[model samples]
Structures are given as C-alpha cells and as structure tokens.
Target chain A: MQIRDILSFSMHAATANRGRTLLMLLAMAIGVSSVVVLISLGDSARIYVIDQFSSLGTNLLIVLPGRSETTGGPPPLLGETPRDLTLEDAISLTRARTVRRIAPIIAGSAPVSVHNLEREMLVLGSTSEIFDIRHLDLSQGNFLPPGDPTRAEAICVIGLTGKKELFGNQPAIGRWLRIGDRRFRVIGILASPEVSLGEDLGDMVIIPVAAAQSLFNASSLFRILVEATSPEGMEQTRQSILETIRARHEGEDDITVITQDAILATFDRIFKALTLSVAGIAAISLVVAGIMIMNVMLVAISNRKTEIGLLKALGASKGQIMQLFLTESTILSSIGAAIGLVLALLGIRLAAFLFPQFPLYIAPWSPAIALAVALITGIIFGILPARRAASLEPALSLARR
Target chain B: MIHLQHIERIFLVGDEEVHALSDVSMTASDGEYIAIMGPSGSGKSSLLNIIGLLDRPDNGSYELDGIKVSELDEQQQAEIRRHKIGFVFQFFHLVPRLTAFDNIALPLMLSGIKQEERQVRVTAALAAFGLSNRAGHRPDQLSGGQRQRVAIARATIMQPSVILADEPTGNLDRSSGIEVAEILEELNRQGITLIMVTHDPDLGRRARRQILMVDGRIEHDK
Candidate 1:
C-alpha cells in the first residue's frame, strides 16, 4: 500500500477508538514532561551557583596557610599546620612576573568606641591594593595611603553600616575611634552594594595589615588574595605564589593556591552529573508508558482481527499490515511529545513564579532527547503486537464472526 | 484458466483429524460459471477459500493462468490475489466505519493507485451499482441489497479476472437475495470467471457447471 493510504488507515483506526488512544497519549505525555521538568530544575541550580560565584571575583587566587591533599575526598580543614604565612611571604609574592597585586589579610573582631557610643564589629586588615582587587567603592575621603609594609599607621576605612552605627550621620572621616585600646583615624567610608554569596559587604571595617597585626598581637596572616593581570596568567600566577610561599616557609608547601576557574570547573562537573542522574531516574516513566502502548495495541489488534483479515483478503502483505500498526504508535508518540514540551515549559514557569530566587528554565537539548526517546520506545514496544497482527491467518480470522 | 490436482487439507480437532478436503481435483476454463455445493462440513467453503488463495492446501499442485500459485510465497500469492482475483463474502465484509464510496475505493487504494484516478473509478462504480445517491452513507445505513452491491463494487474495482464468492446473499431477504444473485450473474456474463460456494440447490442450478461435494470429495460434477 502507498504511504499516504497506510497513514490514513492508521489515523482512522486510532480515531475510531478515542478513549484508548487518549489514555495512551496521557501516559506518554506525563513521562516526557517529568524528564524535561526534572532536568530543568537541575540545570537551574547549576546556573544559580555559577552566577553567585561569578559575582565574587574574577581571576582571583586564594592562598591559605595550611596544606591539604585532594585525593577524591573533602579537603582537610585542620590538616598539617606546617608554617605560618606572614607579611614577608605576602611581600615576596609581589616580586613574581605573573602576579599583578596582592592583599595580605588579617581578620579580627574588636569593639570600637567613639566617645559614649561603642559597637563590636569585624575588622579586615589589608593594603590599599585591596580596594582595586575587591572592587570596593569609597563614598567619602581616601583609602589607606601606599607606604612601607611594616609601617603601622593608625588609619582605617569603615563600611557604611559601621559609619551609621558608631557615627550616626555625624562626619565619620578623620574621626578617632578607639579599637582595642589603640586609636585609629577613619579615612574612608565604604558604599554598600547588594548582598552577594550571602556575605554582607557593608558590615565590616578595614585597617592597615601592620596595624591589625599589632592590635591583635599576631604576626601570622589569615589569607592572601592574589589578582592576576589577565585570565591567561592565572595558572602561572598561582604557581609563582605557591613557590614564593613555599621557599619562605622552609621549603614546605604549606599553602593551598585555588584559582576561581578551578572552583568553577569543579562545580560545573558536579552539577552536570546531578542533571544526568535525575534525568535517568525520570526516564523510567517513559519505559512504563511504552509498556502501556504495547498493552493497548495488543488489545486493539485482537479487537480488529476482522478488519485485518479483510485487508489481508484484499491482498495486503504481512509487512504492510505491520506498518499500519507501527504508524499508529508513531503518530501517538509524536503528539504526546509535543504536548509534554508545552507542559514542561508551563511547569518551569510555575516553579519560577513560586520561587523567584531559583533560576529555572528548560535546557536546549532536553526536548530533542525526549522526542527521540519517545519515538524509540513507541516503536520498540509496538513490534510485538504488530507482528502478532501480521501473523494472523487470513482464512481463520475471516472465519471468526 | 484454473487447475487443481489432488488437493488435500486436514484439521486437528482435538485428537481427531478432520479431513476438510481430501483428494479433490478440478479444472475450469476462463469465464466459466462454476458452483460448489454441499452440506455443512463437506468442505465447500474450504474449497472456495483454497481457490481464493486465502488458505494453502497441505498437498496440491494448483495453477492459475499457467502460474504455479500453490508453491508461491505469501507475498507473491498476495500480489496475484490483488490483481487477478476478488472476493464477495456472505457478510458483505464492508468496513463499517467507511462510507459507501470509500468501500468501493478500497481495492484500488490497496494497490497503490493514485487518489485522482481512484476517485474517477469509484464515482463510475457507484453510478454503475445504482448507489450514487447513497455514496456518503455507511454500511449500516444501507439496505441489504445496497451493501452487497457495495461489496461487489469493491471486489471488481481492481478489475480482476476471477471472482470467488462464498454465499454472497446468505444474509439477505428473498428479494434482496435475488437482486444480489442477479448482480453476480451479470459480472459473470462480463467474462470474469466466477466460482461460488452455496448450499441452496436452486442457486447452485443457476450456474453453467455444478460440482457436488460429499464427505470432503467431489461426489458429482455436471
């Protein structure tokens, strides 16, 4: 028979049994929609994390004082403490060719008293280079001046929150605030930006690294942020920082150098695996839908034996008979897949509306994959019933009432 | 032309083998009007089915128009059946969901004929069968004689050389039955070979040649 003729026959047969066809279509649509929606959820989570990390910084390398081996396990938080990273080590890293600038950090909490008002706040100690490296904007006065690394000038920059609490609309610049029994001049007040990565940028105070070391009575630095001039130099700059720190700490590689790209790559791999696993779990429903197609088709074949027998007597070949039934299933799956894609889009929209923070959207290839899988399962499950119908004896089938 | 030699068919009905056709031999030239008549279980319908290529005889050397059809494969037999033979059944066997026009167009459609030509031929066939006004009605809406006319139109749409009918008017009233019998006779008069299986003696006598089957064998041929 011609393809058009077979298609028409198959379509008429499907429409003749509307209830069964609709039931099969519903099963297939639900299966495909689950796959698309679940995969979309996983993809949205990955994009959200990547966006948050991007907001943190670019071409950044973090140097910590302790070393931990990464051997398919979590990094050891309290691993070997070989040697301390001091101001001298951070100073030596600045001499490397790939390094652009460095911010040696010393973090501690102290109470600030301006006359009768006193408030305890976190104090971050770094150099003037930290202003450019961390993309901080100054709302008033100047940042700490460039000077000798050991000079402990009693000057500081307060965040907008600190300025509001201690000074309370009073001029904060050039005001003397007592920190740990030492007086410091507040030279700059920081402008607050939106909260990113859950760290409030407006609640901290900044001072010179040398002054913080004296105030806290500690010679060791907490962490060093190294900024590479360009992304291409990030790996080279990380190696140079590690070597510079290792040479100063008695030939022991006691620091971990992590680039932003390395963290992003790790997160990318983890999210990709998560997406695949959930999509695989959702594919189980598609298999069940295919089985339902088989069951319905088998019943249809039995019910239409007389029609099949009539066709055979009119000189239809066995292959033609099989093709007619297979065409019916292919049509069903195509319609079901289309409906599923629309439903998945609606589902993603509903989720996004409910939780505005979640970045939910369907991926590009998910619809294509869903459609291909639906077609394959429909054809595979349809084979047994089609073959059974084709194998019927024309004489015997016609003999039946 | 048609020829059959020592055709044998057996059925295993629970542990006992019933011989549906045993050592039956027959031949007829082109355009011959032949009737096969017998009581139930005498294998008249079985013989008609075998002649129509609906069933393969266990043992036979059957030839049609000099082709060894009994040894042909399923597909080749189907090809021959499509172009060389047609069938009229007792139930009319019109696909109930299709309109009368589509019922007449089925055989041509099955043979991969184009829709435009199929349309012209179906229109002509409908007018010839006196069913032009009933073209849009389904089989259930048509009268018994009209349904049989639609079946005959479907059977002859391929313009086959032979028509094998099994009690073509078995379900019709007396007048409708007579009308259906007249149509089959008219097709036979047009030089298409006709082989009919019937139990009615009066109907059997209307044929140019009669074969009486008894106990799975040809008891008489006249």
Candidate 2:
C-alpha cells in the first residue's frame, strides 16, 4: 500500500473509536510522564547533595577516630570519636611541606550574654589558621591573631547568628560579651557560611586556641583540621598525611580520612539506585499500556472483518493488511510518547516552582528512551492483531456480511 | 479462457463429509458469456469461487489462459488473481470507507499501475458507467444502482480477460438489475469473457451459454 493510503487508514481507524483511542493515549502519556518526572527528581536530588557537599570546602578533609561496627553490619561511621588530636601533632603537620595550613580545634556549648541579651551557642576555640583552612571571611572586624598561647585574651570572633543573638540591631564588634563568668571582647563577626543539607555553620563563635584549651581543660590534645593546596593533589596529600600520621603514632591506624570526592561518589551511587527504582515502577505501567493496545487492536480487527475481506478480494495482499494495523499502533504510541514528554516537562517545572529547594532536572536521554520504549511497545502489542487480520480467509470473510 | 476438469471440493462439518462440488467439468472460451444457475446449496457460488482463484478445489485440473492454476502455489494464485481475473459480488462490496473513485482505482493500484494513468483510466471508467458525478461519494452515500455501477466499474478497471460476478444484481431492483446486466453484456461484447452465477432464470437465459447445477453437478447445459 502507498504511504498516504496507510496513513489515511490509520486516521479513519482512530476516529472510528474516538473515546477508546483518547483513553489509551491518556494512559500512555501518564506512564511516560511518570518516568520523566521521577528521573528528573532523581537528578535534582543528586545535584542538591553535590552542591551541599562542595559548599563545605572542596579542598578540606575530615579526620575522625574509631572502628566501631553495628551488630547488623551497618555502614561505617566516620565522625564519632572519643580520642582528641594533640597540639604537637597539629603543629608538626602544619610545619610539613605537603600541608599548607592546619588548625587545632576545641568545641563546647556555653551561654553567651551581650547587653541583657543571652542564648546558648556552639563555641569553637581554634588557632588563627582555622580561618584560612575554612576560607572564612570577616564581615565586621579582624579575626583572632596568634599571640599569648598560654594566657587567655579577652577577644572572640562571633558568627552572624551569634552576633544577632547577643546584640540585636546593635553594633557587636568592639563590644564585650560574658561567657561562663568570663568577659570577652567581640573582635569580629564572620560571614554566614553556605547553607548545605539543612545545616548552617554560621550559628557559632570562634576564640583563640590556647584560651579554648585552658577553658575546656584540654591541654595537649585537640581536633586537627587540615587543608590541601589544590583539589587535584587532595588524594595524594591525604595518602602522605595518613602515612605520616600513622608512622608518628607508632603505626596506629586509629584515625579515619574522608575525602570530599569519596563522599560525593557515595551520594551518586545512592541517587542512581533511586532513579532506577523509580524507572522500574514506571515501566510496570508501560506493560499495562501494551496490553491495552493489544486489546484495542484485536477489537478493531474483529470490527473490520468485512472490510478486510473486501480489501483482500480487491487484491490486497496479506502484508498490506498487516502493515495497515501496524501503522495504526505506531501512530498511536508515537503521539502518546510526544504528549507524555510534554507533560513530564511541565511536571518538572511545576515541582521546581513549588519546592525550590528540591530541584527537578530532566536529562537529555530521557525523551529518546521514552520514544524507543513507545515504539517497541507498539510493535509488540500490534503483532497479534496484524497476524489475525492477515490470516483471515477472503472467501470466509466475504461470506461474513 | 477458463477450464475445470474432474473438480471435487469436500467439507468436514463436525465429522460429517459434505461435497460442495463433485466431478465438475466445464470450459469457457475467450470472450464467451456464460451463466451458471442453481438453487441455494447447488454449488453455483462454490464453482465461481474456485474458477476465480479464491478457493482451491480438493481434486481437480483447473486451467486459466491454458496455465495449470490448480498446481500453482498460494502466492502464484494471488498474482494471477491480481493480474488476470476480476470479481463482482452480489452485495456490490465497494469499501465503505473509500469513495467511488477509490473503489474503481483499487484494481489498478494492486497491479502497480502508475498513479496518473490509473487516475485517467478510473475517471474514464466512472464516466462510461454514468458514475462520474458520484465518484467522490462513499458506498453509503450512493444509491443501490450507483453502488452496483461502481462495483462494475472496479471489476473492469483492470481490463481483465475474465470477470466472475456472483449474483451481481441479487440485491438490486428490476430496472437497476437490467442496467447492470446490460453493462456486463457490453463488456463481454468488447471480447472480455464474462461468467455470472445467478438464481434468476431470465438473467441466466440472457448469457450466450447457460448451465444448470444440482447436487454439486451440472444437470443441464446449453
């Protein structure tokens, strides 16, 4: 048959049962749209996690101590630790040529008061190098300078949250704050850190490392923070640092090193699995759609028995009959796929607008895959009806009416 | 030219054997106008179907244009039907979905004729049958007479050597039936062999040769 004739036949067949055709198209669109929306959401989740992790400083690594495993063999935890890193170790690491900067940190919760305004805040006591390691920016005044390592200087650098709580609508820099019966001068206010994974690092205060050590009764040990010169050299620097630290501690592999890239990879694996699971669920609906297509085609064949016989008697070959039915199925599914893709795009945009934090991004390969799936479904579901129509005997069919 | 010798067609209906055609022998020369008349279940339609290549005789030597068609495969038979034979049914089975023009153009299309030539020939055929004004109308839109004219136009559009019409006017009124018979007779005058099966003796008597069938066998021939 000519291409024009085939198309005309398909259009007539579709219009013959408009309600059924529309319903089938709607079902197919739903299936394809779900796949698009789910995949986009999965992509968005991955991007959100990666963005949150990168905001924490790409060149930094976190070191924790312990090797505890849950009874059910849960994944290993990296940050739960009882032993503290020593100031001597921190100093040695800072002096090393491979290490660009280091900081020994001590953390505690304390009540801070400024002009009758008071609130409990997380306080971090660390050396001046902590600002450089964390890429901290000063918004109001100068950071703590390394001086008088033993005696406590009555100076501190408050974060944006600490400043707001201690002196609301009032100048905080150069003001004095009381912490645990000790008076401290507000030397600087740090800029707000990037909000990541719902955690805000701008809700704390910074003080001198020596003063923190004395106040917390932590004399020799501290939490060591290290930063590499470049992200490219992070893995190599981590290996060397591990080796150095191991050798220095008599071959004790008690410290754990976690790289930013490694954490991102783990997150990628998690979201990839999530995407596949969602796609699999959507595929179930496609199977149902295929069955529906087969049923509709079969009904069409039975309804047009006399028509088929008339064509056959008029010299239509079996192949032509098969092609006609197959074309109908192809047209149905291709249109459904196109509509589904549009619906999916709309769904993504709506979801992003409703929840800005939960980004929904569509991948380029998604539409191509959807079209391929639709065509395959059409062919698979169309075969039975095509064969049935082809097998109909012209003589028997002419006698039908 | 068509010839059938010692043809036998058997049917199995739930363990009972029924002979639709038995020991049937006949010959139709080129340009010959013949009619086979019989009562219902007299094997008139079955014989026409076998001669048209729409059915295979169980045991027979069937020849069309002197080629042994009974020995040919299904594809070969279909090819012969496409190129050498035409069929017109009692119901004027014009496709309900297509216009009268498309119905007449169908045979030329099956033969793979060029589109421009097919349109020219189909237009001429419709005009010759006084269906030019109704060419664009579907079967449901046309009257019974106009529909039969379209069927006749389609049957002769390929200029086939032979036309097998089964009760061509069984569904038409008297004047329309006379018009259809006249059209077939006119085509036969142009040297196309026309074989028709009908129950009306008056229509059967109009043919150059009339054969009477009973119990799957020819009872009389003239």
Candidate 3:
C-alpha cells in the first residue's frame, strides 16, 4: 500500500468516532504537557541557583567556621563549629600568593531606628573590598572608604528595601542611621534587587567589620570571602586558606573551605535529581495514556472487524492491515504530543510572566523528547491490536462472528 | 481456467468436528458464469471461500490459470488474489467510513496505483455501476442495491480474471436484486468468469451453469 493511502485511511478511521479519538488525544495531551511543564520548573530552579553562584565569580571561595563532613556527596547540613574564625584569621589568609582578594564577614541581627522607623533587620560587616568581591553595585554615593580593616568606621551601606522603608522617597546617601546603640552615616545604596544565599540583600544593612564586632562584642568572624587570582587557582586557594586556618587553630582543621563550583555542583545535583523525580511522576501518566490507547485500539479493532475482513478480501496483505492500524495510533499520538507541546510552551510563557523571577523555561530538547517518547509508546502499544487485526480470519470476520 | 481436485476442509466446533468441504472437485473455464446453491451449513460458503483463496483445503490440488496456487505460499496466494481474483460478500462489505469512490478505489490504492489514475478508474467504475451520482455517499447513506453496486465496483476495479460472489443479492428486495444480478451478468458477458454462491433459486436458475451442493459435497453440476 502507498504510505499516503495508509495515512489517509488511518486518519479517517481514527477520526471516524470523534468522541473516542478526542478522549485519546485528551489523555495523551495531559501526560505530555505535565512532563514538559514540571520538568521545566525543576530545570529552571537549577538554572536560577547556578546563575546566582556564577555571578559571585568562578574564582571565589567561601570559608566558614564549621566543617561539614564530606562523605563523598554533599556534606551534611550542619552549623557553627567549636573553633572560632576570627577577623585575624581572615586577615592572615592574605599570606598566600593565590589569595588575590579577601573580604571577611561578620553577620548579626540588630534593631535599626531612623526617626522612630524602628525595625530589627540583618546586618553584614565587611571591608571595603566586599563591593568588588561580591559584585555589589552602588546606586548612589560612594562605597566604604578603603584603608584599614580595624578602623571601626561608622559609615554604612543600606540595601534598597532598607532605604525604601527608612527614608521613603527621600535621599538615603549621606544620612545618619542608628543601629544597636551606635549611630552611622549611610554612605551608599546597593542597587539591582539581588538575593544571595537565601537572604534578600535588599532587606539587610552593611557596616565596617570592626564597628560590627565592637557593637556585638564578638571577636569571631561569621565567614570569609576569598577571590583567587584566576579561576584555575581556586583549588590551590582553598588548600592555602585551609592550611592557614588549621595552623592558626593549633594545627586543627575545623573550618570548611568551599569553592564556588563546589556549591554550584551541589545545587546542580540536587535540582537534576529533582527534575528526574518529577519527570518520572509525569511519565506515569504517559504510560497510563499508552495503556488507555491500547485498550481503545483493541475496541476499535473489534468494532471494525468487518472492514478488516473486507480489506483482506480485497487483497490487502497482513503488512498493509498492520500498517493501517499502526498509522492510526501514530497519528493520534503525534498530534496529541504536538498539542501538549504548544500548551506547555504557552503555560511556561504565562508562568514566566506571572513569576518573572522563577526563571520559568522549557529546555529545547524537552518538547522533542516528550514527542519522541509519546510516538514510541503509541507504536509499541499499537502492535498488539494491529497484530490482532492482521491475523483476523477473513472468513470468520466476514461471517461477522 | 480454474480447477480443483479432491479438496478436503474440516472445522472444529469445540469438541465436534464438522466437514465444511470434503472430497470436492470442480472446474470452470474463462467467461463461464456459475452459481453454487445449497441450504445453510451445507458447505456452499466454505467451498466458495476455498475457491476464493480465503480458506485452505486440507487435501487438495488447486490451479488458477495453470498456476499451482495450492502449493504457493500465503504471500503468493495473496498476490494472485490481488491481481487475478475478486470476492463479493452478502453484506456488501463496504467500509462504512469510506465513500463509494474511496471504497471502489481501495483495491487500486493497495496496488499502489497513482492518484490520477485511481480517480479516473474509480470515476469510470461508478458510472459503469450506475452510481456516478452516489460516488461520494458512504455505505450507511447508500441503499442495499447501491451498497452492493459499490462493492461490485470495488471488487472488479482491478479487473481480475474471476469474480467470486457469495450471496450477491441476498440483502436486496426483488427489483434491486434483479438490478444487481443484471450488473453481475453484464460483467460475465464482458468475458470475466463469474462464480456465485446463492440461496435464491431464481438467481441460481439465471446463471449459465449451476452447481448444487449438499452436506459438505457437490451433489452435481448442470
């Protein structure tokens, strides 16, 4: 039989009962769209996270006071260590040649009141070099004055949210701000609505590291940010920071030195596994849809036995009979998948519009994958019914038995 | 020419074995119109099915136009059926999903005939069957006679040498039956060998030759 003939006849047969064909298409469409949407959501989350880390620069390394035991995969989610990571230890890391820039951080929460607009919010203490190391953009005014790490300067930088809440529409730069019994002048407003490490930078305030340590009456540091001279030197920089800290702590390794890629890789693995899990759940629907198609096709064969018999009497070969039946299923599945793909892309587009920061996107290959899988499953399930139709006895079928 | 020798066929209905056709031998030459008449379950339909290559005889030697068809493979037999044989069933057996034109053009399409040629031939067949106005009508939309006319058009679309028809007028009224019989007789007059199985004695009497079957055996050929 001609391929076109097989296709046209199958199209007619498949669409003959509009209700049954619609049901098959609806079931397959639901399965396919679910796979595309859910997988895209998972994939988008990974992209969002990795994008965050990359902005921190590939040569960056994070030094925390506590060591998270690395038993191969991701380290256990743990907290502060017994050993203290002091600003002195952070300063000492400059001894290594691989460490090109260091920005020591001391984090704490304090009540900041400006003109009775009192709010308890997070405060980050760091050196002037933090602007370059963390890629913080200054919207107005100048950044912190560079020079001494122990200067206890009272000047600070406020985030967009803090600036909005405290000063309303008024100018925030060069304004005095009160935090934890000490008064400081706002030197700059950090721009670009950034969120890092689960903390909205827009909701936090930053001051000189020494002023923060004195205000909190604490000598231990929160964590240190180190930027290597080049991306390739990050590993060596990690080892140098670890060694420098261990020597300072009586030859004990208590601090965890995590490279930027290490954190990015961890997030990458987590979201990939998440994507796979959701794809698996969605694939169950595809399987159920396939089985439903098989059931419907079996009924169709039973219902059209007379036609099958007639075709055989008209000299249709077994292969032609099989082709007719298979083509019906293939057409249904392909059209269903195409519809699902369009729906998913539109849904992702709408979702991206709804939650612009969610990074809603569908991978180019995901639609193709969904389509290919649907087609394969349709053909696979079609075989049994096609085979049944092909093998039907012409005489018995003609007798309508 | 069509020939059969000592054909035997049996069917197992649960635990009971029924001889559908047994020790039957028959022969008919080109352009010879013959009718097979018998009561229900007397193997008339079985004999026709065997002759049409739809059912295999257990022990028989069959030849069509001098080819040893009974010894041929299923594919070869199907090729012979496609190019040399036509079958018309009692129910008209037209595909309800297809229009008369598509139904008649089915054989042509299966033979991989081009679209333009199929159109021309199907158009000619519709006109020849007095169904030119009904070419676009589906089986359900056509009357009993019209459906049978469409079936005959489809069956002979490939211009096979022999037409095997089982109860061609069984589903029609008297006038429609006469009309259908004339169409088949007209085809036979055009030198196509016509073999028909029928329950209507009147239709049987009109054929040039007749075979009477009883109890899984041919009683006589007159």
Candidate 4:
C-alpha cells in the first residue's frame, strides 16, 4: 500500500477509539515534555551560573591563599606554613605585562551604627579599581577616591539594603557611620536590583582596603582579583602572578590561582551532566509509554480481529497488515511528540514568567531527540502486536470462535 | 476458470486429527454460479476459504486461470488474491468505524489506487448498489440490506474474477436476505463467478449448480 494510504488508514483507526487514543497520546506527551522541561531548567541553571561568573569580569583570575584542588566544598584550612597574600603581593602583580589590573579583597563582618541604630553586615574592602573590576554601580555618590594603597581613608559604600536599614530613606551618601571603633562617611549607595549567582548585590558594604585592615585588625587579604589585559593573556597572566607570588614567598608556590574560564567550565560540565542524567531518568517514562503502546496495540489487535480478517479476506498481505498497525503507532507517537513540544514550550514560558531569574531555555536538540525516540520506540513496541495481527488466520478470525 | 485436486485440510482438537476437507476435488468455469450447502462442521466454509486462498490445505494442488496457486508463496498468493478474489461474510463484516463510501473504497485503497481513481470507483459502486445517499452512513446506521449491499460493493470493488460468500444472508431478515441474494445474482449475471456457502435449501436451489457436503465429503453434486 502507498505510504499516504497507510497513514490515513492508521490515522482513522487511531481516531476511531477516541478515549483510548487520547489516553495513549497523553502518556506519550507527558513523557516527552518532562524530558524537555527538566532539561531546559537544568540548562537555564548552567547559563545563569556562567553568566554570573562572566559578570565577575572577563579574562579574570582569583588568587586565594592555600591550595584547593577540589571542584566544590569549602576551601580547606591548612597549617600556616604558607605565607599570607598581602596588599603588597597584590600590587606586585601589576608588574606583569599581561596583568591589566588587580583588586585585593579583605572580607569581614563589622557593626555599623547610625544614630544609635546598629546592624552587623558583611564588609568587603578593596582598592578603588574594584568598582570597575567587579562592575559595581553607584546609586548616589562616587566610590572610594583613588589614592595611596596604605592611606587609611575613613569612607565606605553601603548597598541598598544597608542604606534602607541604616538611614531609612534619608539620604545616606554623606551620613557618617561607625565601623568597629571608627566613624566613616558614606561614599556611595550600591544600585538597585541585581543578583550574581543567587547572591543579592545590594546587601553589603564596601570600604577602602587600609581602613578595613585596621577596623578588622587583620592584614592577610582574602583574595586577589586579577584581570588579564585580554582573553588570550589569561594563561600568561596566571603564570606571571604565580611566579611573582612564589618569588615573594621564597618560591613556595603555596597559593591557588583559579581562572574564570576554568570555574565556568567546571560548572558547565556539572550542569551538563545533571541535564543529561535527568533527561535519562525522564526517558524511562518513554519506555513505559512504549510498553503501554505495545499493550494497547495487543488489545486492539484482538478487538479488531474481525477487521483484520476482513482485510485479509480483501487480499491484504501479512506484511501489509503489519505495516498498517506500525503506521498507526508511529502516527500516534509523532502526534504525541508534537503535543509534548508545545506543552514544554508553554511550561518554559510559564517558568520564565514566574521566576524571571530562573533562565529556563529550551535546548535545540530536545524536540528532535524526543520525537526520534518516540517514533523508534513506537515502532519497536509495535512489532509484537503487528506480528500477532498478521499471524491471525483469516478463517479463524472470521469464525469469531 | 478454477480447479482443485485432492484437497486435504486437518484440524487438531485435543491431539486428535479432524479432517475438515478430505480429498475433495472440484472445478467451475468462469462466470459459474455455484452453491455449496452443508450442515455445521461439514467444512463448507473451509472449502470456500481454501478456494479463496484464505487458507492452505495440507495436501492439495489448486489452479486459478491455469496458474498453479497452491504452490505459490504467501506473498504471491496474496497478490493473486488481491487481484482475483472477493469474499462476503455472514456478518457483513463492514468496518464499523468507516462510512459506506470508505468501506467500498477499502480494496481499491489496499491496491494502492490513487485517491482520485478510488473516489471515482467508490462513487460508481455506491450508486450501483443504490447506496448513493447512504455513502456517509456508518455500518450501525445502515439497515441490514443496506449493509449487505455495501459489503457486496466492497467485495467487488477490486473487480475480482471470483466472489466467495460464506452465509452472506445468515444475519439478515428474510426480505433483506432476498434482497442481498438478488444483488449477488445480479453481479453473477455480469460475468463474475459466484461461489456461495449456505445451509438454506431454498437459497441453495436458486444457484445454477449445487453441491451438498456431509462429514467433510461431497454427498451430492448437480
């Protein structure tokens, strides 16, 4: 029989039993759309993480004291055989040709009180270049003015949440707040509405490195953020920083230098694996759907024995009978796949709308894969029932015994 | 012309062999109207099935239009069946999901005839069977006589050389059964060989030639 004729005939048979056909379609559709939606969510998470890291700065490298070779978990605290990374160590990195700039960070918690209202918040101290390096935006006044690295300027930038808590909508730009025994003028308020890697950007305070060094009563820098002059300069810049820090520390090579691309690549691998594994789990449902098709087709064969007999009596070959049944299942699955794609798209849209930061995106190959697998599974599962139908003896079937 | 020689068909019932057809040999020329009448278990339907290539005998050589048919493979036999045979059943056996038009178009569709040609043939068949206005009606919506007419139309849709009817009017009322029998007679008069299996003596006598079966053997032939 012609392909079109077979398709139409199968399609007619499928539509004839509306409830059963709808149930099968629904099962297949759920199988496909779950794979799609789950994978899209995982992909969105990957993209979001990569975006957050890229936002930290392009061609970036972070130098932390002590070595950490592990992909995740807290950085292990080793015995103090390694020398600390100081402000001088951060400044010495500027000598490398590939190193465009550096911002040494010292992080600590400090109680800042204004008008007798005190709140303890995270405080990060860095050079003025950190504003440009970390892409910080100012809602009001300028950030810390450029000056000597050791100069103890009593000035700070509070984030939006801090501003609301410390000053309560009163202008915070020029207010003075006490930070652990010293008072500092607010230099700026951080911009509204930004999140990096699930961290709210408007919930912290920034101060000059020297002022924070004295306020926190410690000198070791938390991390040194280095920017390579260009993307190609990242490797050379990492090498230079390691060598410079090693030379200053008597060639111990005690620090860990994590390139931004390496971190992003790790996250990408992790999320890709996550997406693939979840997609695999979702594929089990497709197999279930296939089995359901096989089961339903078996029942259908028995139910349509008279029709099968009629067709056989009309000179339909066993192969033709098999083809007709196979065609029916494939059509059902293909339509189900199509419906699944539409449902997944709708689900993605709803997710994107409900949680704007979730970053749900559909992978291009998902629908193609889902449809191909659905069709293949439909046929594979279709074989047994088709064979049974084809093997039916015309006389026996017509006898209805 | 059709011919059969030394046909043998056996059934296994609880490990006992029951012969359904026993060394029966028969022949009919083109356009012959033959009636096969027998009581239940006498194998009239089995004989009809073998003649229509719907069943294969254990030991037999059958020929249709001078071609060796019993020796042909399943596919080759199917091809011949597709082009050369039609079957009508007691239940009418119309696909309940399809309308009368689609029912009649089935054989043409199976033969891979294009839609336009299939439509033309089906339309003509519908009118020829006086079912033109009932083309869109499903089997359940059709009267028994109408359903039988549609079945006859479907049986002849491929324009086969021979038509086989197994108790074609068994489920119909007397008036509708007579109507159906008359349609079969009209098709036979148009030069297609008709072989019908029935237990109704009155209907059996209407055919030009008749055979009576008992205990898997022909007891009388005329």
User: Of the candidates shown, which would achieve the greatest TM-score relative to the real structure?
Assistant: 4
Per-residue accuracy of model 1 over A1-401 as CA lDDT, tens digit each: 78998889788887778899899889999999999999888988898889888776678898988877543655548765568889999999999888888899999889988898888888888899888887888899999888786889999898888889899988988889988799999999888644667656677789999999999999999999888989999888988887777778777777888898999999988998999999999999999999999999999999888888888889888988899999888778777888888899999999899998677889988999989988998899999999999999989988876
Binned by DockQ into CAPRI classes (incorrect, acceptable, medium, high), candidate 4 is medium
Interface RMSD of 3: 1.3
Over the stretch B26-140, how does candidate 2's per-residue lDDT look in tens digits? 9999999999998999999889989987788999899999899999986677778777888889988777878999889877766567778888999899889998888889899
Off by over 4 Å in 3: A70-83, A115-117, A167-172, A246-251
Q: Summing lDDT over every window of 10 consecutive residues in candidate 4 chain A, give the lowest-scoring window.
A: A67-76
Task: Tell me the native contact fraction for each prediction.
Answer: 0.56, 0.27, 0.66, 0.69
* Candidate 4 TM-score, true structure as reference: 0.94
Q: Candidate 3: how large is its RMSD? A: 3.3
Q: Which stretches of candidate 2 lie over 4 Å from their true place?
A: A67-83, A94-110, A124-162, A178-184, A187-194, A206-232, B107-118
Cα lDDT of model 3 by residue, A1-401, tens digit: 78888889999999999999999998899899999998999999889888977887658999988767643655437853468899899899988999888999999999998989988879999998898988889888888888889899999999888899999999988889899999999989989768886878888899999999998999889999999999889888888888888889987778888888887889999999999999999999999999989999999999999889878888888988998999999899888898889889999999999998777789878988898988998899899999999999888899883
Q: Global lDDT of each model?
A: 0.89, 0.82, 0.90, 0.90
Candidate 4 - chain A - TM:
0.93
- Could you estimate the TM-score for every candidate? 0.90, 0.88, 0.93, 0.94
What value does DockQ give for candidate 4? 0.68
**Docking quality tier of model 3:** medium
How displaced is residue B219 in candidate 4, in Å? 2.7
Residue pairs with colliding backbones in model 2 are A85-A222
The 10-residue segment of model 3 chain A with minimum total lDDT is A71-80
